[model samples]
Target chain A: MAKAVAPRGFARERVLEAALALFAEHGVNGTSLQMIADRLGVSKAAVYYQFHSKEEIVLAVIQPVFDDMARLVRIAEAMSTPEAQQEVAVNGMVDFTVRHRRVTAVFHGDPAIDTLVNSRADLSDIIERLTVMLLGTDPDVTTRIVISVLASGMYGSATDPKLSDIDDGDLHQVLLDCCQRLMRTRGAIGDLRTRGAIGI
Target chain B: MAKAVAPRGFARERVLEAALALFAEHGVNGTSLQMIADRLGVSKAAVYYQFHSKEEIVLAVIQPVFDDMARLVRIAEAMSTPEAQQEVAVNGMVDFTVRHRRVTAVFHGDPAIDTLVNSRADLSDIIERLTVMLLGTDPDVTTRIVISVLASGMYGSATDPKLSDIDDGDLHQVLLDCCQRLMRTRGAIGDLRTRGAIGI
Candidate 1:
């Protein structure tokens, strides 16, 4: 509805909105600049004026996710204990995923991240940090899978079509429940890992 | 290794192998019949002789997964208890994923699944069954996410390049531990659902 009524100056924001909608539905690989232009009822050149490539648009689309991650990490850092940090990590993920269920479906659904520049390393880092924060240590294979399940569990299923009938409130509770259950805080999943970069 | 010397009569088998490789690397949407034929060093007509469309080829590629799911379900049904049934489901999944980590990555990674013949319903059914089997009941969102995390945790992470260095043996153990911990086995998650078809 907002896209239908936005005036001329909002083309960049409009492009992002259309691209996100297309990305959510058709997937990043399946979506095209032409599709975004069509969604905006504008010329491909006009869309091009704001962004040169699909890769650029995708980065802009997911930039907020990066911001959100940074914010979550910062908040998590403030927590005094590993268990508290784990709570922040789990709840933070649940809240973010729940809020943007469809948007996340694009990235987590197909890992279209690989198609982006070299963001795979960035994503691997985020999952790694969350894994460390969630468990508070260097993971054995078991805890590593915990992160996989914990991360994709909320991200993947939030957008699962079969569960689409499920509403947001219910979905939030479900992810919170699962992440909390799966988190097993152990020996030092804290400052030793993410903080201070090369800590002692 | 297998495709190199299978002989001319194995065009059908070779085509499947090449197509799977292309799908894994390029994704189902990105992969083309020409690409598959090129990989086989054959004409598109020859590839068409084996399978008329990419969709058909995809179905054939994942048919084994369907067969495995059926076999696992049958084996689970024979088990005397839900706990036993859940054990079969979890271990069966871990073993299959560890063995075909890359191949499963093709499907589980991008869910090129959506492109395959409405296997969305079929895939949803499989996830639902596994979720129910693991937890043994009609789930609240919490348990549903458990299956998502559990399934994707193993399927999504098995081929995660970051953890790609880990061997099959360790991957198997990791998945087993994660799934075992997550399966809570509550209420009557048993014959009332999957078996007897229309059971009371």
Candidate 2:
């Protein structure tokens, strides 16, 4: 049994935090509820009171990130122009990813998380809306490729242990700039740069 | 029992191809030697004859991709200038990823694969060399971030089922262009364009 720490805030929140840390270190399949309870310094019964199953806990852990994604989609959808939509969506995503790096890292390569995320109709709709907003209506292969690439970059860099030495503030800005460069068409590059969308 | 098809090259090679396809459809954990044998229309003993365990099968499946990566690293190292090195490394990576999208896709969200890949000292050294080649000698955070982002994009887009309708040639060119765009410094953008490095 691992040493326990005092529970913080809500019992639910503490369980999630403890689970996220364990999941990050040991992976989802490797983690057990007992470990989460041990980390929380609570009884296994206490942990079960908050969530019935490991899957439920997994869902709860990811819920906030999904909520943030949906919120960002809503905000981006209200923007009138594609450029504004793209800017808002990209910026929001980067901010969310940076803020939740640890949680996201835990979910990053886990297939169980992928299945759970894909099964949610609401999340799918949000992702579709976000995708359209980023690439506009009738996105071609080029647009899709560029957007996916930028996403990969943002997520990979944020979670990369190799980049631990870099400050989050600096990392965020550079990631944003790189994404903008990838997103912009050759013709729009000059205009976007002039509009101060490419960099801080 | 799967319907036996004529062996193409060697029994070992045939088993690997069949296993790769099955593994891609069902995850490594979800797949078994019995299934591979069934796919090959052979007995489980035959499958075992080719490879003793699933781990060995996985290694054989990934061996080609790793070989290609090593080859690319050597090619990039031979280049005289940093610019040349970056271009060669990026182009090679995109090409390799696109070519082996199926095998890569199977490996994509699997943690077991991650552990296996990371544990290999040779593979790690190859990846390190490839990263250094792409980012040059003394890469800043921005360079590292950009390289990682482009990488994410290439792999993600190449393996995405949603983009299946898009022709490989078109996807390849677009991916290369996006990678080049992410890689070039603002000052070098003009020079790279003039040199026709940004497109096919």
Candidate 3:
């Protein structure tokens, strides 16, 4: 049973990796099965054997990120306090986003991916769960907006060409620092206001 | 000369407004001149008379936003200090983004908009200028990333469905509060660390 599953799993992984690269470069609309097959140095039929359609391949490519997100949700859930859960969840998300920068870029800018993710109940459920964990039970508009900013800001910076010169460790540290600053719950805006950080 | 330009300008403005609505609903790639014309109840030729191509319409559609950004740069530049400039820039940007939520949504997610904006040096230059105004002369990765989060966060939240129930005034105040918290320049990360806001 192990042997039977291993080869299929290996092939599927290869297909997804190739498809992701193609999707990143040419976009989902521009990429075709033939190009993916060519990149893999395999026949179209072999590609079809693994994934029936381009949509399926796209779904497969995104599945691992969702899996990681699910794992993050589980880790956060095990934490004792709400604060602990928020910390674990935010750090886990930042690490996942940075580690998968290429995949994140594809997901970030692609309309096809947006439609697919939004339409899929499973994906949206995971996102809703992540949001709940991040914002807590009684989050206000400020908290929701700040959380959204923290996320997209991380994604945007990670994929920025200007910051490509910086090493990954430095980038990761900087992102975490900025995210933590944005994620501060108590007296953050008031402190900034008191210090005249924002002009009236 | 005024007579010649007035009618053309009015027609051009109508064409752009119609085009923006179609682009928002159908996407830039999915939109066409005929659709813009159909929406405006004008002939395709009349639309073409105002703007030669779909690309021209897109450029025209975005020009007002760029004009607002230019106005923001001027406002920031007139401020007395870098800190003042940062405050004004962040606040103005948040206001602009929230006020123009529909157009921001189109710009935020559309690949066609991305390609067009990136290709045009004028648009990118405005963005660079805005970044400089927000971050000052020499910003580290953290500052840059945080500024990005503030901007995209405002954009994301302004268009959020859950936040739709929020009135414009309430949404604006919440966004401002959140942005100010994220935009603190001096010892931001250090403050977070000292407060134990970030575990690391």
Candidate 4:
């Protein structure tokens, strides 16, 4: 199970909150430790005392969300049946994603993060865990592709300007519907991966 | 139609290319015209001569992709029937999106660009044209949501690492299948705004 490297504290939480706001306001590439310290009314030394570097701070900020996802995956893996497990897990993942849209937005919006994660085997391992959960047991390439597509679709739909006015309830329904359709279509295309996985 | 602002020259194209690479490397907020000039072995003044500001350079980089999408939209609109037009448009849009995945990656990856587009009504107009083309005349809210979801799904999937090794032809087929599924689901949902216009 994924856990925080540092214990939760008022200072760390404050810094993370500031980082999220600043990162969202000015892309992650745009925000700096000095800026984050300034936003928090703290000195750079104080910020450094809590987190060693900007990258560490970013990881700290994103780690909670990632852990939340990992926890969900663990739950899904613990399920008795793939269908029940997938539906619950997929919905949980969607809920987690929607609840943390800013995280999703910031994560996908910064290319630097992509490079960083791709370069680190540890980070890739974390992602692979989720991918494995997303694919269930022994999924083929095509099944993996469909799952990836559905997840991205859900994330994109949440951030889409065209659906900006959609309420959370309606947005959730739309996501559920789209995911179900995607899964069904995958099965129809000689896809055996999600054989009995019902609604997402 | 959205065309290139002017003819391309090596200097200008080189600047734009450098700017994109840097912007993609560092977030748009992190990248500067000076950095781009330095990377290109050109003076900042030379860079300014080609593009006055970083924002202008970023827009120029994305313009070609937008133009291609707009052209495809126009082609789809020119079709005789709505079904035929949607099929053509969907296929064309998917093609353009997949073909220019790198460029599309920029728009989705950089929050600064997303902010710029949202804040600048004029810039948003370009995306508005694509949305209109996708939805057709008087499309409802749900339709827009589905379209956005499907488009995002296709985009995210194409850029996904798991599918990175898959050939383009296979990816295209995957995308086409996803689009067809979207159409089928949208049809099942029926019209949220109107009673008729049901079924695919």
Every candidate's DockQ is: 0.30, 0.35, 0.34, 0.43
Q: What is the TM-score of chain B in candidate 1?
A: 0.77
| Model 2 C-alpha lDDT per residue in residues A1-200, reported as the tens digit of each score | 13332342367888888999899888888899999999988899999988999999998888888889989998998989888998999999998888778787787767678877789887677778888887789765566667777777788778877777866766676676777777764443344335444443
Which residue pairs come into collision in candidate 3?
none
Off by over 4 Å in 3: A1-13, A78-85, A118-121, A185-200, B1-13, B79-81, B118-122, B185-200
Per-model TM-score on C-alpha atoms: 0.70, 0.82, 0.80, 0.68
DockQ of 4: 0.43
Compare the candidates by DockQ and give the number of the best one.
Answer: 4
Question: What tens digits encode model 3's per-residue C-alpha lDDT throughout A1-74?
Answer: 99999999999999998988888888898999999999999999999999999999998778888999999998
Model 2 ranges off by over 4 Å: A1-10, A185-200, B1-10, B118-122, B185-200
lDDT of candidate 1 over A1-200, digit per residue (tens): 77765654477788988998898778787899999999988899998988999988988877777668767877897899977997898899888887877667777755566546345677557665766787577555555656765676667777777778766765675566556556642222342244224642
**Candidate 2 chain A, which ten residues in sequence have the lowest lDDT sum?**
A1-10
Q: Compose the digit string of candidate 4's lDDT tens values, residues A88-157.
A: 6778877877777667767764666777788878677767777766787886656767787898888888
Clashes of 2: 2
Candidate 2 CAPRI assessment class? acceptable
Q: In angstroms, how far off is B126's CA in candidate 2?
A: 2.6
Query: What is candidate 3's CAPRI-style docking category based on DockQ?
Result: acceptable
Arranged by DockQ, best first: 4, 2, 3, 1
The residue-level lDDT of candidate 2 at B141 comes to 59
**Alpha-carbon local distance difference test for all models:** 0.72, 0.79, 0.79, 0.75
Q: If you assessed candidate 4 against the hidden native complex, which CAPRI class would it receive? A: acceptable
